[model samples]
Target: MEPTTLRAVMAALRKPETGCPWDLKQDHQSLARYLREEAAEVLEALAALRPGDPATEAHLCEELGDLWLQVAFHAQLAADRGAWDIHDVERAIVQKLVRRHPHVFAEVDVEGADEVLTNWAAIKREEKGQAADHEPRLLDGIPASLSPMDEALEIGRRCAKVGFEWPDLEGVLDKVKEEVGELQAESDPVRVEEEFGDVLFSLMQWARKKGVDPDAALRRQMIRFKGRFASVEDDARAAGGWEQRDLDQMEEAWQAAKRKGKA
Candidate 1:
C-alpha cells in the first residue's frame, strides 16, 4: 500500500471500537523503544547492502517500511490527542527541506560542497536564533542524548566550522596519541574514566579527519570479534567445553579462528 493508505490503516488500528487492543494501548512514551529498535534495524539492513544487490534492496525497503510504521504509529497517537498527524509530519519536513536548501530551491550561489555547508549552517543558526537568543555556543545545538561517539563527531564538526580545529590530520593523530598516553597514565577511577573518554573523542576526531565513520568502524570490528569468538567457542566445545580451557589455549583457538574466519 501507499504511505498515506498505510498511515490511515495505522490510525484505524487505534480506533476505540474495533482497533487492535495492543495498538490502542500504546502511547508515545511506550512506543519510543520500538521506534529506536526499528531505526537500528533499518541501519543494519542498509549496512548489508551491496551495489546492484536486489535482495539487499528488498531487505532495506522492508526495514524502511517498518521505520515508517513507527512514524505512522506516533503520528496516529498525536492525532488521537488532537495535536498533529501524518500529513502534518510530511508538510513540516517538506517546508524544512525547502527552507534549508536555498541553493536547490532558490537563487543562492554555492561554489562547492563546503560553501553549501557553510551557508546551511548560517541559515540554520538564523532560523534557530542562536545569536538573538544569546545562546551562541555552536555545540549547544547538539542533543545531549546522542551517543558519545556521534556527539563528539558533531561537536568536532561544529568547532571546525568556527576555526576551532586542528591544522591537519597529523594534528588530530597527535591529539589521539596524547589522549591515549593520558589515559594510560591516569590511575584514579574518576580520572581514568575522564581520560578514557578523551581518548575516544580524540580518536573520533582522527577518524573524522581520515574520512572514516567511527561508529561504522567500531561496528565492523565488533562483528569480526563476534565471528572469531563464536569460532573459539566451537573449538572449546570440541575440546570438551570452555570450562576446561585456559586463557592461553582459548587465545590460540581465537587466533586460529581469526585466520580461518569461521564463526
Candidate 2:
C-alpha cells in the first residue's frame, strides 16, 4: 500500500515482511544518536540563515523535516509495540499546552512573560502532584540526559529561583576566577579533570547570569574558528602544503583571517 501521510510513511517503513530491513532493526535506543544529530543539523541550518536567502530557508526546512522524522520513527516504534502512536503524541502535546497556558485558555490573569512563566511552573508542579507548600528537591525535574553545560545552567537557574545565587555579576565573575584558579592549581589528572569541570560549570553559570545561551555562544565561536582555520589551511596549501608551513606562518594566516572577519 502507498503511504500518503508522514505517519503512514513511517508505519510503512516499519511494517514487517515488506518493510525496510534497516528500519526493522532499529529501536528507540538505536535511534537516539540520529535524533541528536538531526537536531544539531537543524541548529546549524538556523545559524546559516540570512534575511532573504531562499536557499538557507530551504535548508532549514529540510533539516526540520529530518528532525521531525526522528519523532515519527520513535512514534512508529511505540505503535509496533502496541503503545501510543503519532496522533497520540500530537494530542498529548496539544492537551499539555492548553492545560499549561491558563492565561490564554482560561481566565487566569498574568502581568508579563515572567509572571506567565511563574504560573506555568506552578501549574506544572500541580500537574506532577506536588503540593503548593512542598519544598521540592533542588534538581528534581532536570533531565539527566541534558548536556553537561546545559545541566550546569539549569542547576544555577534552579538555585537562583530559591535565592541561592550570587548577588551580582561581579560575584559570578569572582566565582569563575576562583574556579579557574582551582583548575590551574590541580596536578593530579583526576583532580585536574574535576577542577576543569568545575571551571566549565562556573562559566556556564556566569553565561546564564549574563543572559547568554552558552551553547549558542560556543557554536558561534566554533564556526568562527573553523572559518579562520580554513584560511590558514588555504595559506598552507598555497605555500606547498602543511609540511612547508610552520606554526608562526599558520598563526599569521589565522590573524589575517580574524582581521578580515571571516565569520
Candidate 3:
C-alpha cells in the first residue's frame, strides 16, 4: 500500500471518536516490547517457510500484521505529540533509503555486492566520523546496555578490526587453553573467579572469530543441558529416587543423559 494510504488508515485507527482504545492508549515505551516480539515472530515464520506449509504463511501474515500494528501505533503517538505525523515518518525513511542506496538511485559506480558494502561502510563511517585504523571505535558504538555475551562479541569484533586479533582459529584455541590453565592454577577465590571468566570470555572471542554467535550457541547448549538433566531427574525418580542416589551415581546418570543427546 502507498505511504499516504497507510497513514490515513493509521489515523482512522487512532481517531479520538471511533478508534482502537488500546492503540490510542499506547506510548513509545509501552509499544517498544511489541516491536521485538513481532520481529521475532517474523523471523520464526521465515525460518519455517518451506514447501507445502500453510501454517507458515498464516503465521507470516499474522506477524507482518503485528509489525504493521506497531508502526501505525507509533505513528499515531508521534502525531499526537505534534512532533511528526505518520507522513513525516514515511518521508524521512523514504529519503534515507534513497540517500543510502547511491548505487541504484545515482550514477555512483559499483562492481558487485562487495563494492556496495564498501560504499555503505564508507557512508556510515563518514556519517559517524570513524577513524582510518578503526582503533577503539566499534566499541564506542556498541550500547552499554547490550548483554554480556553480546558485549564480548562486539568488543572482539572491534579488536579484530584493529588487527589485535588471533591470526587463525588455532590461536584462539590456544588462547582458550591458556586461560583454562590459568583458571586451574589460581587458588585465590577472586583470582579464580577472574581466571574462569577469562576462559569464558576467550571462548566467546573464539566463537566470534569462527563466525559463531556465542550467545545463541551457548543458549542451544543450555537448552540441551536442561532437557537432559530433566530426563535424568525423571529417570532417577522412576527408578527409585534422586535422593536415594549418591552424588557420583547422579553424576553418572547425568553424563549418560548428555550422551543420549549426542545420539
Best model number under lDDT: 2
Q: Provide the lDDT at 32 for model 2.
A: 98
lDDT of 3 at 181: 97
Q: What is the C-alpha RMSD of each candidate to the true structure, in Å?
A: 2.9, 2.4, 5.1
- Candidate that beats the other on lDDT, 1 or 2, i.e. the better one: 2
- Across residues 1-263, which tens digit of lDDT does each residue of candidate 2 receive? 57789998988888899899999999999999999999889878877776589998899899999999999999999999999999999999999999999989999989988788788888888898988788478788789888888889999988887789999999999998999999899899999999988888889988999999888777778888998999999999999989999989889999999999944
Name the weakest run of 10 consecutive residues (lDDT summed) in model 3: 42-51
TM-score of 3: 0.68
lDDT of 1 by residue, 1-263 (tens): 43358877887789898889999989989999998899878877766665589998999899999999999898999899999999999999999889989989998888988898887777877887767357566667688768778898998888887789999999999998999999999999999999998888888888987899877677667777888899889988998998989999999988998888744
Error of 2 at 56 (Å): 3.0
Worst 10 residues of 2 by lDDT: 42-51
lDDT of each residue in 51-92, candidate 3, tens digit only: 477886888788898888778778778887788876787898
Backbone clash count for every predicted candidate, in the order shown: 0, 0, 0
Full-model lDDT for every candidate: 0.85, 0.90, 0.79
* TM-score of each candidate structure, all chains considered together: 0.87, 0.88, 0.68
Q: How close to the true structure is residue 2 of candidate 1, measured as C-alpha lDDT?
A: 35
Question: How well does candidate 3 score on lDDT at residue 258?
Answer: 82
Q: Comparing 1 and 2 by TM-score, which wins?
A: 2
